[model samples]
Target chain A: MDEQETRKAVHDRIDQLDVPQDLVAAAIETGIDQASGKQVKPRRRRHLGRWILTAAAAVLLGVGGLAAVNPSVSRALSNVAWLTNFYLHHDDHFNSFHVNGIAKSMDQKVTSNGVTVHLVEAYYNGRTIGYTGEVTGLTKAIDPEQDWVPLDLDDTPAKNLTSSTSNFEPTKSGFRFHATFLVDKGEVPESVLLPIRISNVNGVVGRWNFNINLTQSQQKHAIQQKPYDLDLPGGEIIPVSMTTFASGAEFTFRTTTDGRYGFIGISAIKTAEEDQLIDGTDGYYASLGITHLPLKEPLVQGKTYHVVYQYQMKTDGSPEADIVGADIERDIVLWPAEQ
Target chain B: MELTLKEITWAQQAVAGDREALGQLLKSRGDYLYRTAYLYVGNQADALDVIQEATTQAVKTVAQLRDPNQFFTWFTRILIRQAQVLYRRRQKETTMAVPPEQVAPMIDATAHLDLLAALQVLGADYRQALQLFYYQDMSISEISQLLDVPEGTVKTRLRRGRSALHDQLGGNYYG
Candidate 1:
């Protein structure tokens, strides 16, 4: 084949592969939503969140809390070990869930090619859906640092799925896996069908699929909600209804301005006693629509925390990273102390 | 490969934080992006993942593109980087039990199977240069700018890649 023939062949070969237009459109919509800060990118590496929380964890020390880890489920199979370990070693982000009793036991299992993948338990708090499971039957232990567990949701409702972060640990039989899938859609359905597929296990290749049902947790209700009017520079007084939860806070506001405006990030959430500096997760940055902020520490009851945010011109992609309570014109929404 | 006036307008609007315009721009280039990603990853699922990730990055950094006419090149660069990231990450996990057919999927290229195989055997750098130069209809300078390499380096890769393909196919494939 000559150069022309080769070019035609290359084009023809690439064209042979079908492009799913629906999926592509969905991805574009998702990307726009995330870039505009309607939602966060699904999977975040979280090294920064963890490192910043090291100090918050120290401040939260001796702040005793309690709630029973669901007693009805089999303690042996439903390995909440991932959550327990995360709370113990990594950070106290999951401590609120543990205290709020927000986990559901999903003791489902699928086995293939001498391997068993157990979908043990799941925690769904409106915004995030996390799963912890066990994998038995491996030739050798997996190094979680180097090896990735190929557990992924299949393509039926995958368009709604944004990002997922997973962790694996070596077990005697195989390994245990913990993964969290972020749902960016504002109104999450009562139940979502997660068709999980594991394409590869160690060097053993085969599809180990599981159709796990995820029901949204009822405990996600706002413990405290209040209406506060935010005065924008353009003389636009946007009424923001802030809802605080054990997980984080949700800002529900509508803007009718012609100028492009979106909720970027909250710089600080302050109380009479403590001023907690937030990583960008505290709020989604953008020009319009609802913004969900996952807070590092749960709001303390009977404490009036002042959630202060400043509107600044977007420098790079995430200006929230550099937000350091600089003396700029700011907006404050008062969350009157929870009684 | 030339940018149309409408596309240029959409790119400008997209960069100016117009979601509708951005969505339109992405839909226009969606197929091309998918094919490019598929070329690197060699599968449907991974290719889709690459596109989605690239789309997210594009939306995040579209403002960084100073030239609206260069949207295709800019987005392609993002897609290629994502494809490489996923390809390298998954290379370690895939096993030998998976048949070659499953990896590349079935394409009706009975006459061009040898060509495809030869292209696959070429090193990553050679394959990229060849694909950009031939399939993407890009000049050496354009390929150099996209790949962030000197124009001479791209020309060398194209020459060496053509020689390698000619040696395999037993003809002047690049003539």
Candidate 2:
């Protein structure tokens, strides 16, 4: 075939590919459900403590001395826990620990530029730290397009800092703002004094300096680490270490120097469920930290686990290696019966 | 496809947390997304799965989008990424037990089988470049933006992809 005929042939083939209308409709329906938050399953029962915290705060504020004397209210207030439920529900890394009850309270507040910013709650697991709070005092809605960096606690921005903001339900004083920030796995400090400066908030800037005590959560658990050698399809052996935590397992390996051989991902199974694939985290290239392979349920001390590591080989000029396929390199059994 | 003003408005509303607007925007681009996904996975069922996943991801992360007018480019990027991921996962699952020749016979009959087979021999980057060029008729600049690569890289891929395709199909050069 000539140039014109080749173009026609390729175009004809691509055009002939068909998409079913029913599939399109179903996909749109599913997208709408997910977008509207209908598909998000209700979080674990641990979140009930958060609801109790909210209720306790309201009663303490409303009834004053009378509510303080109530046994249940007093007990809840003493717990004064920071709920990691929001992060636990959304992030795989944060979900590894079975955290219940709040940490120590750092309910600090400041007023400047006619706006009040409150640091409502803070939680520090062994790995991740997060804080949630609110900002009030605005005549009109702030620009939705602008992403205001509210605070910079550390000398540098945390490697995986994530922040989210939502408008509070409208009240007579106007709509307040609720915001939260989660700093991913980083070096933990005893205490951090976060200096907050929010600019362009209804034409006025808000500033606050609050000290947060990174009190370790009672729910933190120690991870058991074991080292092993994983053999790839091409007979190349790579050293890898595995760590098992309450929430999931982490595999750490070194990346290849030639950029040809690399760890792709892993699949794992407990006795109760079928094999489930876990995608490698965005942090995979950071010395090959295979973070967050969540178990079907939280890890039990004696339950056996089976896992297989997958790796890819991409040697130049090797057609066999050029095939885009990840092969299972090694199978591992965790918590052997003798152990 | 160039987005109309109404589609752009829908995208803006979708980014502003309007579920109905998201549905409308996704429905408008569903066919194109599915077709593009099909080019990557080479099967109708897997392509549909990729489209659904891409739609869900786009809706969840819509707030991060900066420009409403660039919705197609942003969504296409998400769709292609999802397709690549699913394709990789599928390859891993069947690579040992089943080879490409056995799977080719099961592909949907609507597509030209010979061309599809030839396309499979090209590297993923080359196949994607050729598909976007000839199938979607996207400009090299547009493809570069969609792929998040430099324009020069896109041009090189197109040149190399055409040459590879010509070689695979016995010097059937096009343009």
Best by lDDT: 1
Per-residue lDDT tens digits for candidate 1, residues A233-297, read 43132434444443444544433333323233344565556645232331233334444444444
Query: For residues B46-119, could you state the per-residue lDDT of candidate 1 as single tens digits?
Result: 66678778877988888888988888888888888898788667655554333222321221212434555677
TM-score of each: 0.45, 0.38
With a 3 Å backbone cut-off (N, CA, C), the pairs that clash in candidate 2 are: A81-A102, A82-A102, A82-A103, A96-A247
- Evaluate candidate 1 and give its CAPRI docking class based on DockQ: incorrect
Q: Per-residue lDDT for B43-155 in model 2, tens only?
A: 55567567777888887899999998888878888888998998787655442333232231111124355666777777789989888877777888888888889999998
Evaluated with DockQ, which candidate comes out highest? Answer: 1
Off by over 4 Å in 2: A1-10, A40-339, B101-113, B173-175
lDDT of each: 0.58, 0.51
Worst 10 residues of 1 chain B by lDDT: B101-110
Give the range where candidate 1 chain A is weakest over 10 consecutive residues by summed lDDT. Answer: A48-57
Q: Can you list each candidate's DockQ?
A: 0.18, 0.14
Native-to-model Cα distance after best TM-score fit, residue A266 in candidate 2, in Å: 55
Query: What is the lDDT, from 0 to 100, of the residue A67 in candidate 2?
Result: 10
